[model samples]
Target: MRPNYLVIILLIFYSCNKIETRDEVYPTKLYEKAKYFQNENISDSAFYYFNLAKNDYVKINDSTGASKSLVNMAIIQCNNGDFYGSIETSLEADKLLRNESDSTVKSTLAANYNNMAISSSFLKNYEESVAYYKKTLQFSNDAENRYIYNNNIGDALILLGQYKEAKKYLELAIFTKDSLIYAKVLNNIARAKFLDDQNYNPLPELNKALIIRQNNKDIEGQNSSFSTLADYYLEKNAEKSLLYSYKLLETSEKIKKPEDQINALQRLIMLDKPNYLKYFKRLTAINDSTQTSRNKAKNQFAVIRYDVEQKDAENKNLKLRDAENEINIIYLSFGLGILIITLIIGHFWNEKRKKSIKIEKEKEKELEVKNTELRYSKKVHDKVANKVYHVMSELENTENMNKEVLLYKLDGIYQISRDISYDKNDVALEHNFSQHLSQMLKSYSSENIKVPIIGNEESLWEDVGDHSKVEVFYILQELMTNMKKHSKADKVLLDFSRENDLINIVYSDNGIGISEFSPKNGIQNTESRINSIGGTINFDTKTENGLKITLSFPAKN
Candidate 1:
């Protein structure tokens, strides 16, 4: 009796491992042909093909192909509202592909991480989404892929209520070379800005995103951009929101994406409940077709499973002795398989080394080009532009100088030279932080403007790059220009300090404070520019003196 029980247990275990299926020629034919399905509206068939491909790859021992198929299936699952299932499948693929050092494999791994993040987003697990997106950045080295991953990271952070961090990553992603990524990053940033209460209006960021999407002719991106802008203006400008929603509906129709069309129609319905019936009917038809197709595919899968089970039973009954003899042959085949795998591993290692060398050379070439551009710009500013300014200065200071005449002539020359040299090179300000502050103070030392400078010069320029120096210059220019024009302050003090990784800049004047002022056009422009550079600005209006502005930024490299 005990021996019989042990045999029964073994049989149950083998049965559990077996794939149950139906016994019918039509079902088998359908199962095989299902692998070729690729209909946009038929999410079920697409999902079925994805699973078939994954199983096919596993049978062939192709890890990379299996991972790809799994990712594709997860994408469809995400679209069909099975977000948790999608996340699980993506995680399994990620684990299998992690050991692969191939860039193409790594790219797929990054994509899996991105899909997992999207699934997490559907579940409203913002923190987990952010964590997975961060993982994507680690695996993705391709510039275009990195750009999208960075933007997704920003979007996830924004959803987590980390506005400042979201903006920082979004700026980096937008600064990337890919236009599609740039446009998408801009849209995400706009959403973040809209969420931040500090921003009175986030229309500018939305407009910037719209312009970029339109310029790149990204229809999907454009659809998103228009929808966002429409929602944004819905509260403040109802007419504008309605107009953009209608425009988005037209674009969605042109693109022929049913889901997007459904979204646009829904948004239009919200704006105009009376006219929405036209779009609503179309949306319902598409949605119904999608659900029907998915149901049919699910039913077919059940049929295939039943047929496969019957075939396994018949094959097992007819080949019991043959399978026992083949067991020894399987052991022999496994031994040779291990040896072949070892050789393949060795080949892959050498190939990876060669690719790394090529990548290094390309990076070096890019860095060289950037350095050459900076050097050329420095030469033009230091030699050509500076000399012209000096000659004009001497002419103005001469004994019989015509002040008005010299001033007008110098202004034209300055404008013309600036235009000519603008593309040649960027102007580098004084590298010493203290000297830069002093120059700013001197520039505002006229009868109407008084700015006292305070900062140290020790080692400020030692490790800093031209990028940081230029940012400081632009900040100073904007601040002083604001003070001179609007502050009405007769006295101003500028303070600067560097502590650890942070740089602090304080500008205060004895003029009219910010309470007496609204967001000046200049202030708005400055705010946008400063945000683009990943810096924060706080306006202290409680001061009885002039407006006090505090600027903090990460030290430039």
Candidate 2:
């Protein structure tokens, strides 16, 4: 066993959480005094001081302190026999401590759950006891806590008549270094085994555990052993069972354990038929007293928390009203200042601003008309004029090209010109773009003009955006239109290559390079496209053989 294992065992099994209190603070002082009363076994005074401390913690918005105080009050409530009230108080503490994971907060939470589990066990809510015990294990840092919690869960399961499942946990709980723990496990294990199979012998284990508890003078252990043994021999040896019952009653009364007293009286009522009525009367009196005490304890705990809640609710209402009044005053002042500013600004500059806006609108209207005319002119020349010239070259080149193919091309050109004003692009130029581009460049080829395109692989179009591809298509189409009309170039070469995300195009011809280097509207339209894609264009008309136009742009939009 590790050094701190005992400390952890004490913390878990005995619920010994170290109270941290600051003497300088009144709330902490109250908490310290509450701890003193709690240690002295003055529960009502402890509950009073803890309630005061909780309200103080709430006033300061110290949720951790408030939750810790509540956990302490809940334990006191459970010890006072208010099981249901303890469960409610522990749940309230858990709400305050939710989403907190620091070590101290976790420790407080573990204590909170352990209290609930104990209260649940007392309430005969074995299922709830098992559930809360498992939840307690989840927060406990000590691995050795498994022995304690697993045994508790097993005990609950035994009462639930889940004997087979009960033994599984009890088997793991035989950590023998702790004698009381081992004896507790041994008693429960024998009970579970005997309950599971009537023919199974439990006396050896049962007597062994009873002897260990007797030697240790463990009052709770002795009570458990006394009850188990009396029940086991109730039919077999009534005299022996009655002896354990009298011992149980004597010990229970000496220790002020009313629950154990009730159990012992019931056994005596059944085994001692001659004195049955006397034991039954005693049983009735003790039962009434225990019930009255439990009820009083429950009411006391509830009323304390309820009073705090009522005061806190009233405080919230008062704060909300004060905040509302301050907000209304601020809003009134802000409204008046905004109204004055609005009137002054409206009187001084409203007409001048209106006049300025009208002049700007008129200028924008004029520029929009000019831009519209320029776009229309460019689209018509690019989509109509260039397309018609390319068709003319196709007709002149093909010996017997069918009229249907010719009509389709002309109809496509017609639709483009018709929708040119509304259309932002020539739809889907990126579909099989490489093959389409190759076909378009080579279409301008005739017997005299050998236009060979290089590096027109399909993969070059991989990362290129649709809009950029459309612009590049238009630029190339405009260049081809000019080459066919004016450049008078033969044996034109179009080279394409890619560097990372950039596309590079090189165009050259063997004949008739431009001398003056002047570009018309079609050439200017190509220049605009190059600039639009944020690319560079270089026209080397002074090249030895022909005009060399080089361009580079981003492959993606």
What is the lDDT for 150 in model 1? 79
TM-score (C-alpha) between model 2 and the true structure = 0.52
lDDT tens digits, residue span 1-557, model 1: 33335445655555455435433223233334444554445766756656655655665577787788778767767766667767877877876685657887988888898899888986889888889889888888878777777788888898788988998888878878877777788788878877776455777767887888888788888898888888788788878888988888789889866666777777777788778787678778978976675555444544443454566567767667654555445445455655566577768878998999999999999999997776455444433544454444355445687779677757755664665545543343435555754764575576545566777465544455556656556556666666665667888887878755677788888887776446754466456545645778888988776678898777654
Work out the TM-score per prediction: 0.45, 0.52
Off by over 4 Å in 2: 1-26, 306-557
After TM-score superposition, the amount by which residue 164's alpha carbon in candidate 1 deviates from its true location, in angstroms, is: 2.6
Best by TM-score: 2
* Alpha-carbon shift of residue 331 in model 1 (angstroms): 22
Q: Number of the top candidate by lDDT?
A: 2
Task: Report the lDDT tens digits of candidate 2 across residue range 1-557.
Answer: 23235334443443222223323347998999999999999998899889889888987888988999999999999999988778888999999997557888888888898899999999898888899888888888875676888899899999999999999999989865798899999999999999999999999999999899999999889999999989988888999999999999999999999999999999999889999999999999999999999888887777776786788789779856865665555446556665666677676678888899999999999999998898789788877888888888888878898999999999989888878878765653735888888778887888888888899898898978777787788888877777887777778889999966889999888768877688878788888888888898889977667688998999876
Evaluated at residue 244, the lDDT of candidate 2 is 93
Which 10 consecutive residues of model 1 have the lowest summed lDDT?
22-31
lDDT of each: 0.69, 0.85
The per-residue C-alpha lDDT of model 2 at residue 193 equals 99
State the displacement of the C-alpha of residue 111, model 1, in Å, after optimal TM-score superposition. 2.3
lDDT of 2 at 261: 98
